[model samples]
Target chain A: MNWFLKGTLTATLLTMGGVGAMAAPGVTEDKIVLGAVDPLTGPPSLLGKAHSLALKVWQEDVNARGGINGRKVEIVFEDDGYVPARSLQSLKKMVEVDDIFALIGTSGSSQLAAMMPLIDELGIPALNNMAVNSHHFNPPLETLFVVGPTYCQELAAGMTYLVEELGLKDEKYAIAFQDDEFGDDVRCGYLAGVEKYGLDNVLELEFKRGQKDFSAEMLKARAAGVTVLVSGGVVAEHSTLLKEAAKNRMDITFLGAHSAHLTPVQALAGSAGDGYYAADYVPALTSLQVPGVARFMDLANKYLSESEMDSLNRYALSGYAGAMIFEHVMTECGEDLTRACVIEKMEGLDGFETDGLLGPVTYGEGVRHAPTGIMVLQSNAEDKTFSIVSERMEVE
Target chain B: MDYFILLTVSGIAIGVIYGLIGMGYALIFKATSVVNFAHGEIMMLISYMAFSIASSWTLPFWGLLLVCVFISAIVGLVIERVFIRPMLGQDVFSTVMVTIGLAVMIRAVVVLIWGADPLLLPTDIGDSGVEFGMVFLYTSQLYAIGLLAFCVLGMWVFLRFSRMGVAMRATAARETTALLMGINVTHVYAIAWAIAAVIAGISGVLLGTIYGLGPDLWTQGLRAFPAVILGGLDSVFGAAISGILIGVLENLSEGYIGQGLKEISGFLVILVVLMIRPYGLFGTPEIERV
Candidate 1:
């Protein structure tokens, strides 16, 4: 009985030592675990699924290459279902239960906002590429690293190109936007373009989100003689607007934010999506001309199944780019990777390139968001693909 | 003038869809005195079913519509039996709550099967619009208007002349009394649901063709609610007319006022109309003695 008691004590001490040697939270000698919260079950699952697939591909690639500092990386995903409260709860669960070292795949603007307090409290090094809302960075959190420009900046840049470079300055401009923060951001860009180009701002309209019918809005645009329309709709609304314009026989040039750079938009809009300009921060899915996109497609085909491959869109590229940036930061931190170390390295990142997937990412002290350059893309309705139509326009 | 004409035409097109769905709501409520909160989900589910069938087979528009209507009727019957029939003796609120739960479940099941991505529904009618001088109309829009008219006319004829329709009306007026008079109230309830589902299915498919099919398509049912209230909750024909009136009013409001008033215009009308006539334009006023 004495020998058994002594042995049990020794075993317990050894277990304590083993647990202590695991280094950081969610970090073991052989593995580093990360958390992702996204709308995985609702209408926004398209974005979340693509994001997860990209992360999965990146994880596979990193593990194959011995991971960061010889530790395999893993991601645990929680579905927020696009609800802000759910996003907060999912983040809480991931932090408390999963013990994630870093966070990625923060959902929409409101969702990310909901998780911000928890992220700050936990000191989680988070990379947000999905939503680059300005509020998230106005008083930047020390550990939050934002990639990509805000919709305002993106659309503004795209409009600049349309007016100055594409020679749409003479056309009557109109804005049909959703009445929300996202729409307001897009409208800011539209207003900027109108002011800079001294163009005719014929009409500015707002519609409710998830509105199916846009016939009245299109008719209103037609009445205003809008020759160049800036569509501030996200995914489905963009297609609906185009369809309405087509039905109205309104000969107009349409422009959209980064969300328009999707295969689904082109597919849904059918012939109406032809020649529509979409401003994007990342190279398009079909922009295989870029080395980064070519490599991504190769990796995607290799790692993802046939259906998963079909699901690849701009979101996938952005997610992969984000994962690549995280990997860079982690690689730079070497074997001494703590959440603080990752954040420190991320803040010091300069001209980090995704091999042309995105503009050179540069972040420094006091800067949370790296205003990456924007590219304008045009959809070919026949093939349901978008091709880069302009050089990357650097936004200040 | 062209803009007005365009707005009016477009409003009528959307209004017809709203009316069709509203009619479904009215029919069910009239027969069972219990609102199927799943009316929108039924519409969305049927549309998705139609989408799946359309994707897998090469069927003309008419053939696809027929198939969807038939399938929707069976779904309605099943829903009535499995969910509604069991709760016949329960409180009306409980039955309504069940339908609300069923709505969420149907939405989940749809997302599970088709995923969250919105898909373009292929149809026989192409994207080209008919040019009526200054006014333009999509082929789908024209079809929607025609279908709404056809359904409303058929419903009117059925209720006025058919045996089952009269039985349903009797059952709706007084369930126990209808039962005493040798009418099977359960059968009438099932038939009402089936017909309502068929109407909703037709509207859903039309809306799908016009707007594309997505999980959020169920919200269209909610949008048609104002139509139902304005037309009288239990008056199918009144709901049909109110749906169009609300649609036109919404469009005109958006066209002129233009500050996102289109969505609220219908509800505003409902409020004003209800304030003046609580029973709606065509609804039967109920009387009680305490």
Candidate 2:
């Protein structure tokens, strides 16, 4: 027999033998360690750093509250640098070396996708709050639970709001998106909305990722007389699109994915930044209206420095909310806190609350993607804030 | 037709910025025969510097530009002295590799200071634009075009007329012969780096105003490469004009052809140009007698 086959059989035997005798890998009598992988260094660190900080805030807050079921909570964070291969490596290291009980911060969609196989093989109960796609939940992994809606869901809901609430069903609706998976998701939502509303879809344009110039796209949109635009840009692209629209003096209503609900986008767009809508699953950091957010802000102020406070955003809120759900599930799993028990509990979650930080998280039989409320927020450039303009625009 | 005009005008406006950056690459390669892989990162660093300067001092546009020019000159001199000078006698590929290393270090340092978030350069210059009939150009965009013209004219006069510029051209033509002819070869290389850095610095601030400064801004350095190769790897004049050409081609392709074509249009032109004239349009061909 080959050495590989021999090692595989031995490893299988060792795993089967250990599974019956050992408690969950990361659980101890005094502490429960969770693992996270995020882009802590590169350009995507804008999202990753803020996100990890939010998770830090949750760690502090939870530990201060005596942790989950009298055991202190410890989180092990690994920097993936936003690379998919690095993400897989980080997850493996966390599972093997760190011996983490669960993963709470699964980074970007593609990065998470890269790490999904190891997660499945190891049966790691991962709570993903960062990036959600239909692929993450459909034929859902038994142990992976996702909070918040996909970009498609959020965009579709935004379309519903624009069509049903604002009565813009007659306007020339269009989507200018990056030519990638994320952009494809946004287009899916836009097309879904177009089909649902029976609206005139005048244009659907795709531009390359990292594309700064939108003059051509805007000209095309303008020539087509597009009035309503669904922007699939993340940050700078959104601002550039708005600026281009403003430069042409085109009175187009702009809607974007949650990535647009950022101060930089507005700041970059300058005077042209105002009056765009972003569909988000979580409240903005500036949103004090939500009870959970107000409390999180209070904790953030107490725990984080002013510079750290600057990193607070919807990404942070979602991260904190995901931590809250994880805490709830683990606490309910009792003192033993086995991986199976935690997975079972997560699968049975119903109406788990994070104090309006999210709509409500509920996972069911053969369904791991939780239903959450979506909000359409309008950007007020002067204030660098988003005001919620809709109610329960949740797409289950 | 209006759409075509709009795309073309915007294309030229953006093309000038690309040319400005491409000039930095061509200038370095022209003097040293070493391609600066770090050109983009250097632009990003200078842009962040401009952002910091504009934020703290509240300098007017021209005031900020002047400060950037000074800082970039110093930065270029420092980089050339510290990094490039040591590898002077080494293989050109080694020097290029050092630049790639410098690029990585500069990128890391920028992230360390700026913390990875996209920052808008704190200036009111980006606030407005001027429109003539069917097309509009941001004030910064206009500055970019004017600056490129100034650079082209200045480079033309300097290389043709000025003693220092003539020395640089001589050094570029034949380093050993220029050294034999009593040219300060090291000084020429240093001057080239400083001049290129100043160009990059100005381009950064202009682009920062146009697109906002981000970690990803270094990408403009790479995006401008097609302009450089299409112009000629070693031709500053070619780099400038091809930048305009490539920018128009990309815009027109996207405006007329489709979405994905714009991204590839410059590369397509470069492939064709390289196939036909490897030295590029208006690039002086180099021949070696075996």
Candidate 3:
């Protein structure tokens, strides 16, 4: 048994060495390997799985189109489970072991922050569509290009639409946010909305993550006579807050960050989720009116399994768009494909379109983030879907 | 005044759930002198089990409760026999550590079986609530409070009259003395685990109904820890009352003080209560022979 094990290890090492000798890092003559780190196993898997599925669909489609410069694209996904330390470790393994040329599907803001130094150290060109934090772009790295607006930008734009377009500036506004960096971003937008519109700031409440009950918070909101509520929660918390409000019979206009644009939110929130506004960077998943969404759905149905097709949401659209952008950079690099060449193309990218999936993306010169605009969506409880209620509005 | 009443009522409803879970901890600690750290995981597993069952068939609330209780009791007995029975004569700390390990294993297994999605437990009562003037109560909240009362009454009767219950009490008092008195200490331990598991199962189902079930549901067990400490780790009745007290205190603190005071209010009460009465409100003072 010991001899057999030793022989297997020796053979594996020989194979790895042979592969290393035959190719440049993450790029063989016929294959260009890419890597992704996402929260694939824990609570955040809802987003991560869709992210991976989208990448898979893109990979299949790109390969079917005769690959990028005759090199079949291969993507390796690592599950970070939404932990920052794990995200760092996953990126290190992807760089040193898998020798991935570029990275897509970065984890949450903090997780990506943990992996930022490693990404810079390795000089790996990466695209981030999931988490768009201000810190990532404030002092930009050489190779990381971010798409999508930050939560602050999304919320601020949504609030702007509510106050300016909907004419609810005089209403008593309040914010219920989680006590974390994500919550802080939401608060930044809420403050911006309040300052811009001169709305009555009635109440501001911060809750711990994973807090199941919001009875007291709802009571306080009621006590303050809050007419407009900014829900600063994601996923289950979004549904939970709405549920509590429904129970209290509080009749208030509700708005949520982009994360609340999920079908699960509407399903979980049931009747209460109806008519709630959600701010997002991308077009609605069920928005067949959008040409990009129609194309994505057609490709997704052809490539993804039935369950995978059903699981397709806004994250899938973002992930597909991110992958599409990366594909374009790889295509532009052509036969002289290298990390430096890819980065060069990415930095010069401007007016990049996703065929209406998102607003035109542009990153050039010192700019690291693009598509800093948001569209407001309203939930339709009957169909468990969101409809675009506002055109793309940029946030300063 | 309406806000206060609403907050207090809701707090009491949640406090009843805390008490229900705390009783499971106290029951095991009383019998075996070891904390069942996996009590919350047991609650979580049973709740998930209930979720699965409810998904397959539409059982009335009472039928669902009975099914969960039966399945949970069996799981409890099996766990005790497999994990706790072998460590019976060893240091009590070892048994406690075993429970902690069991907790981690249960959490992993649960996540494996049921993916980490927050699922709503479908029931006949769907977001229906009754309003008495300004005070409104969701049916699930009212059910939780009523069920806690029923369980407490049932526990009192069982402890006061049943032969097995008396045997459990005897075993808890002194293991060797109870052995000499012809009480099967091992049987008592198994019974205690089964009863505790039933309590946890019921509490978990009610909680899942109210707040939706997710992987984080197990954390509520840890949240109930303060209630057991304040009520007296060995006092079943005390745990129930303290659970309500903690719940009310937490809500009142959050309602009045605002911010995120609700999460810490229970611990603050536990700290003060422990400082004043080291043995807890109903726990017997231990007179150790030096």
Best by DockQ: 1
| Cα lDDT tens digits for candidate 1, B130-221 | 88887778888888899999999999999889999999899888889999999989999999999999998999899888889899999999
Worst 10 residues of 1 chain A by lDDT: A1-10
For candidate 3 chain A, the 10 contiguous residues with the lowest summed lDDT are: A1-10
Segments of candidate 2 deviating more than 4 angstroms: A1-21
Lowest-sum lDDT 10-residue window in model 2 chain B: B122-131
DockQ of each: 0.84, 0.77, 0.60
Q: After superposing candidate 1, which stretches have Cα over 4 Å from the reference?
A: A1-22
lDDT of 3 by residue, B7-75 (tens): 898789789999999999999999999999999999999999999999999998888989999999999
RMSD of 2: 2.3
True contacts kept of 3: 0.54
Residue B99, model 3, lDDT: 95
lDDT of 3 by residue, A221-262 (tens): 888898899988878888888988888888888999988998
Q: Candidate 1, which CAPRI tier?
A: high
Where is the poorest 10-residue window by lDDT in model 1 chain B?
A: B120-129
